[model samples]
Target: MTETLLILGAGQAGAQAVLSLRQQGFAGRLMLIGGEPFLPYQRPPLSKAFLSGALPRERLLIKPENFYRQADVECILDIPAVSLDTAERRLTLADDRQLPFDQLLLATGGRPRQLQCPGADHPRLHYLRTLGDVERLREHFLPGARLIVIGAGYIGLEVAAVAVKHGLKVQVLEAAPRVLARVTGAEVSDFFARVHAEAGVEIHCDTGVVGIDGGADTARVHTAAGDVMEADVVLAGIGLLPNVELAEAAGVACENGILVDDLARSSVPGILAAGDCSNHPSAIYGRRLRLESVQNAIEQAKTAAATMAGKHRPYTQVPWFWSDQYDLKLQTAGILQGHDRALVRGDPRSRSFAVFYLHENRLLAVDAINRPAEFIAARTLIPAGGRLDPARLTDESVAPQQFA
Candidate 1:
């Protein structure tokens, strides 16, 4: 009799894990559990294309029903695992049914960071992280709806783009000195600030939002800077905290995320974790990072699946991410943190193209706007294990691929 390999959470990580497991010839019985009712879907488009009414909702699914059936993977959608027994290697569902597993993969991703200010519980205040959330916001996506978005992060900005396009009076409030402070440089942030401002979207940088003032049909957003912005809807895109409750409860060694080895294995034997809920110490960047990119989900999932199938190879893939807003397509590869010096290229005024970020000499990170070739070339600069000359980088005549 084949023992089951139970995979918790059917998001990108779990869905990719199942596919990778099958590809690696894991003949064990598969059980995939998820809190979401629908099939595994890509979340990036939710705030951009789906919100903008450019892409249909159905197209976001990772796989159709037929794929799961063909792979012999049993899916328990819309159900969350209530608890897990470490000694028995078993899982307890909401209904108290016990599921014995030979091995387990935890892809229980992160949840949206909620605000604690006044009127935070109001019905008009929205946080877009799931498909259902987008559906609800779609109703208010029409023209003339005053939309106030807090946080100038990717989600907030993407949502603002869609709202502004629909003729909504959009106002974005960022406590940071500029937009996207954590991800990119001051140049990128200032560029987006100009673009959004030119689009007639009101942006308040270096401003702190105190609370959301709730009313009968709308809310007044109060900022620490003394600006009271009125809106029909308020969207919060603060950040996410990992859903590591189950792992921590089961006595698994946890840190910023579930402490996992390079193979994506948890501290416990026969247990593994991936996706946004995992933090693995990497040899590439020589640091620990919990990546939230789709690429990480797919590649780390492959690591877990391959490891489960008895392939003991370390996961060593370069991290990459992409974001699309209006006409700008920003692609980035490698982690950019703690870089001493940064080089900026391209003209943000025209919004044409540019690749800018830090590197001691190696290309630690590259933010390419409308430049796919540079994005691809920068990927090699990191792992190539050589310091790229800063002078050659800034020279307009030199191509990024010439780093070779």
Candidate 2:
């Protein structure tokens, strides 16, 4: 009997799973489903190039449309899977259609965290999560328009940079004491803060937005510090909440995201999850993490597909992420948590440097800004658990190979 595999969510992870399955010689039935109307596309570009109109919508697609037809993969678009019956091996779509499957993969990525404050429902208030979001926000990127951006994370900072390029006055409100506080170290955060400031982005750190008020034409952002900032458009890039309701409803263990093992297998047998929606143990970092990067999505999907194809393979890829703001390219590899020391290689003043985070003598992570060579070296060194000398790392004359 030919077994059928039904994949939920047609984002990067889901699309990669289909390709991986075929590559692994899984000739059984394959069906990829997504809530979005379009074919699986890249979401990272939506905030920058796509928003700035530098890249068209067609370029965001992961594969050509006919690739699905040629691969014999059925694509169900513009519809969402509302319920999952793990016991019965079935799924119910939003349109009340129930489909049976021999195996299931949940890649229902994530949704943008919406502002709960008043006036958040205003038409001018935007959250850039989908292609449609960028399209709507692009309409408001006129010259001299006021853009109040809440949060200073990658998404917020990227959007602010793009808005400034379009001649929009961008003001970033961050609740943390510094920009990129949650991800990067203090040195890297300060560097980015200075970079954005020099780029004409007014950053207000530790400023909590109490509420947003006003109507369609304009909005007033009220801060906890008794300040009201008016804006033509309000953009909130707080974070993302992983889509785990379907997994949770089907009795799958979830904590922040669907709990999966290194193989991307959930607690329930015959079911798996990946991408931003799955929390899995990282053999590399020795901790469980739910990564929201495309690198993690593709790697996890490949692991899941291999496992489904009767080839057991563990996912142990080192986590890496990148961000594009203004002309600066920030590439980060590995997790920086619990790092006690940080060594800076190169000068931040020149806008080309790498910050290497270490615990004792072991390399933990690296944040490379406009330094691709250093980033590549760190990616190799960190995963290999190479020893490093702090003095050598700080000296620019010392090559990365010396430490390895």
Candidate 3:
């Protein structure tokens, strides 16, 4: 009898798994389920190109409709998997439909973390996580509108950049001491704060929102610093909460995300988890990580698919990510956390440079600002985990290719 593999969540990982399982010659009864109505689409561009009117909605799809039909994969869309029974290997959809599987892949991804303050449920307040969310927010992106953004993370900053460019008066409120404090060093964060300031974005770090008072026309945001700011619209991008409730309900192990091994196998046999909803062990980092990036989703799904296809490929890909803001491209390779030292390679005053993160002289990560060559080189160097000369890293005369 042919095995049936059911994949939940039609985001990047689910869609990638569908394509990869076929590529790996699974030839099983493959089915992909998504809660959203549309096909699997890219979420990264939702705040940047898609929100700015530069890219159309059609271009966001991971794979066209014909690809699924041609590959003989079954797609159940717009219906969420409401419950899971690991013992029975069955999933129940929101519409009361039951489906059994020989193996399962959980890729439910994550949802935006909303503010807990009062009046947050007001229609004027927004969170950018889905296509519908962005579309709704875009309706209020009028020129001369007062837009108050809460959180200084990538999503908030990206929205601020686009709003400022669209002629809206934008203000960003971050509870942290500095913008991008959680991800980058002080130098990188300071540089971006300067960039946004010059671009007409008002950034208020060390400011915490206490409550929101929403009226028919505008909303007033009260901060902990004893100040209230009114805005025509409010957008929050605080963080993400992984979609692991279904797995947890079914007795699957979960912490920050669904627990999985390096090969993407979960605590339950014949079941795997990947993407933003999975916290898998990283052999290189020697710790478990739950990454919320497109790279992690794609690569981890490939590993999950390979395992289901009877292949023995371990997932040890050096994670990489990129963000675009006001003509600035920040490409990062590896995880910079826990690095003992950070070195700058070019002049930030010139608007192009790279920050190399080292731990005990070993190259751990690199944040390349408008520097693609170094970013590419860092992707290769990080996996090798080799020690490098600190003097040569900061030398502008030396090229990235020579680092290896």
Candidate 4:
């Protein structure tokens, strides 16, 4: 009997797994299941180009519809896997169909963390997590509309930038003291705050939305400061929660996310997890991390595929991510945890600089603002674990090559 491999979630990780398996000479029965009706597509562009109407719907697809058929990968779209039975090696779909498999990969991804306050269910309140969500929100982006964005993170800031370009009055409310506080340092946060402010985005840092009021035509955001700001549309961009319920229900280990090894293997034999849903140990960072970036998802899927094909390759690529807001591009590499100091090279005022996070002369991470060359060079230096002189790193006269 030919062995059957079942993949859940059909997002970037699931689709990549199918491709990687074929490339690695795994000719077994391949099946991918996704909750969304459409084929696997890119999510990053939904907030920027796609939301701005600059990118068409067809461009969002990762592969043409025929690619799945050509690859001989069976795709079951618009239905979700309701439950998983690791003991029986069976998965129960929403329609009560049980599918058995020799091996399984969970790439369920994540869902947006919704606002819990009262009136959050109002018709005008919006959250962007899927293509459908963005399409619905796009209709409200008329010129001169009032957009009240809740959260100072990438999604909120990106949406604000897009709204500003469309001639909308934007107000961003961040619960934290500064923008991008959770991911970036104070210097980087302040720099982004200035950039967004200069783009006509009203950023209210240290402000929390207590509740929302009103209906379809408008919304009034009640803040922790006893102030109410009305909006034509309100967007909640707090963050995401990993889709690990299936893994947890199957008795698989889960901590914050589905616990997986370097090879994306779960505690249960023949079961693996990847993408935003899995939290795996990082050989570079020496800790368990659940990254939501497309880079992490694709790399982890390849690792899972290789391991399932009996190659046992580990996922050790240095993690990297990027964000676009207005005319600025922010690129980040490596995990910035445990960094004691940061060195800035170039002028933040000019909007072209790189901030290097170091620990006792060792590079840990790099955040480059509109400096792709420096970002690319820092990616290599980080994984190389090479020591650098702080003075030379910060010196504007020195090029990035000198550090090598």
Clashes of each: 0, 0, 0, 0
Predicted candidate 1 versus true structure: per-residue lDDT over 1-404, tens digit per residue: 88679999899999999999999899989999998898799999999888888899778999988999999999998878999888899999887778999999999999999988877888889898899999988888879989989999989998888788889999999889899998987767877888888888999888887887767688988888777888898899999899999989999988988989999999999999999999988787999999888998898888999888889767787799988877998888887786777677666766756654555576678888887877888877777757777777777688877755
Scored by CA lDDT, what does every candidate get? 0.86, 0.92, 0.94, 0.92
The residue ranges of model 1 lying beyond 4 angstroms of the native Cα positions read none
What TM-score would you give candidate 3 relative to the actual structure? 0.99
Candidate with top lDDT is 3
47-158 in candidate 4: lDDT tens per residue?
8999999999999998898988988999999999999999999999999989999999999999999999989798999999899999889989999999999999999999
Decide which is better by TM-score, 1 or 4.
Answer: 4
Q: Which residue ranges in model 2 land beyond 4 Å of their true spot?
A: none
- For candidate 3, the per-residue lDDT at 403 reads 81
Candidate 4: 10-residue stretch with minimal lDDT? 395-404
List ranges where model 4 is wrong by over 4 Å: none
Clashing pairs for predicted structure model 3, backbone only: none
User: lDDT tens string, model 3, 3-70?
Assistant: 99999999999999999999999887999999999889999999999999999999999999999999
For candidate 2, the per-residue lDDT at 225 reads 99
